[model samples]
Target: MNPAPDPELALEVLTDLVRTDLEACNRLIVERMQSPVALIPQLAAHLVAAGGKRIRPLLTLAAARLCGHRGQRHVALAACVEFIHTATLLHDDVVDESALRRGAPSANAVFGNKPSVLVGDFLFARAFQIMVADGSLRVLDILATASATIAEGEVLQLVTQNDTATTEEQYLQVIEGKTAALFAAATEVGAVVAERPQAEAEAMREYGHCLGVAFQLVDDALDYSASQAALGKTVGDDFREGKITLPVLLAFATADETERGFWRRVLEERDQSESDLDRAIGLMQARGTLQATITRAREYGARALEALSIFPDGAERRALAGIVEFCIARAR
Candidate 1:
């Protein structure tokens, strides 16, 4: 048997395997992102060409391939998935008032929020056009619903943000709608376009959902542990923004009276001093909450791996499993 692939290289290997289809997907993405209004394409291209890893689109392509699909439609569908994700990123940066994305100034920062939001609307419209062109109601329904769900998730997060009382269940609900919904749609549509059996399609959906949750959890942890270069943005951004991530949730759940006061001051009241982020990290470490979040990530990663067992063993399957490893290993 081939030696287990390094988690770090899993995405590279999968990219190599799916290079042709991905290239087609890229072409489709560029073509669709264009507008008679030059500024739209210019701003959209700025974000798209920035290094994003294209993991969601890759999942769609890999899922189609895993289900033995040999069609061209998956390429366009993968591009559609990517456009939805990119649109969200543009909108999210504006919503968060973020300065940087993918290690560069965010589009909203350089282009202004109005243009960024409009261009994001253009991308969303373009994504639907592609879905319609594919001419499958099932694909349209899946992606359309995911789009609505993502909006709901973002609104829900807004409601929960800076609220110290946000529960773990509520946090999971937010991530599920914002992140995992698209992931599940991306993979499930691959099987739908492939005409796979219902069981296999459901398996793909579960796999993507689990992987997405694990991916977001790792991102939350990395906001504390990773370097600026590793994260492609400033560390402690979530803390600075007063976002209540899993680590913060776990820490608050176990805090004493003094710790609870500190959390409320920072998270709820948004009253923070320069030293607060460091103290927050210290508290999380002392409470083992960061590790606890990572441990929860591992559980989801295992669920992702289990979901893949329904597929026949092959390079595609193995590479997908490596994605799970890579998502969790980033925490280490």
Candidate 2:
């Protein structure tokens, strides 16, 4: 049998395959982030320099190449995707009151909430400028709708926070809106720039949607199980913030009254003690909820892989398939 796919290795391979385009995209991101107001660029640069996997923008570059795009339009569109993602991260840090992002102080922590929020708005406006410059109404519509959907998702998650009665379906809706919508838009716009047919664009959209769901599920599981270095943020952030994730929902579904009291006290009342996170993790482990969450992520990963079948056999397809492995393998 083939050796298990290594997610880091897979990511490196994808990065190498698109190294040139990725460089161009990075340059575009830097160019577009500059402004007359130094703080706008300074604060934005802090977050941008912190660096992420750039997975969403990578999807745009890879999907366009997979659809036979040879022009430079994908570079601009990829930059637009990154701007949108960065803007969201800036806003998220403020709203979540998160101290860290990607193993460093978050923009809000360094620049204060006011600067972070305004800079995030600046990035969003810059993204719109790029979209209009591209002159594709379809691209604009896809990204615009995604931005709105992401907001709706964040609001839905806010509504469900600290609510132990949050259903699995409700949790899925939250992720699909907040996370999957942008992933879908990122990939779909690739086909749009390439001028591919609607069916192909839909396939890419499906792939990204499934991948995004799997990505978030794995992230939620890692919050309780992974090391601080692996997680790139506080391990118990969700638990501390009373964010309802899949693992919590699964564990809560099988809890007795005594255990329910523990959850209510910690998650609902936010009356957490020092040992509460450990106890919460222990409950999830004994109940196998963490593993169950990973299993669910793998199911979505499978669907993401299936979505790529319509594309012919090639390195781009393989790299995209490996990305699915990369997202799910984080749970391992």
The number of clashing residue pairs in model 2 is 0
Clashing pairs in 2: none
- What digit string (tens of lDDT, one per residue) describes model 1 on residues 120-229? 89899999999898899999999999999999989988999999899999999989989999999999998888999999999999999999999999999999988888
TM-score of each model, in listed order: 0.98, 0.98
Question: Pairing residues by index, what is the TM-score of model 1?
Answer: 0.98
The whole-model C-alpha lDDT of candidate 2 against the native structure comes to 0.92
Off by over 4 Å in 2: 1-4
Per-residue lDDT tens digits of candidate 2, residues 193-218?
89998999999999999999999999
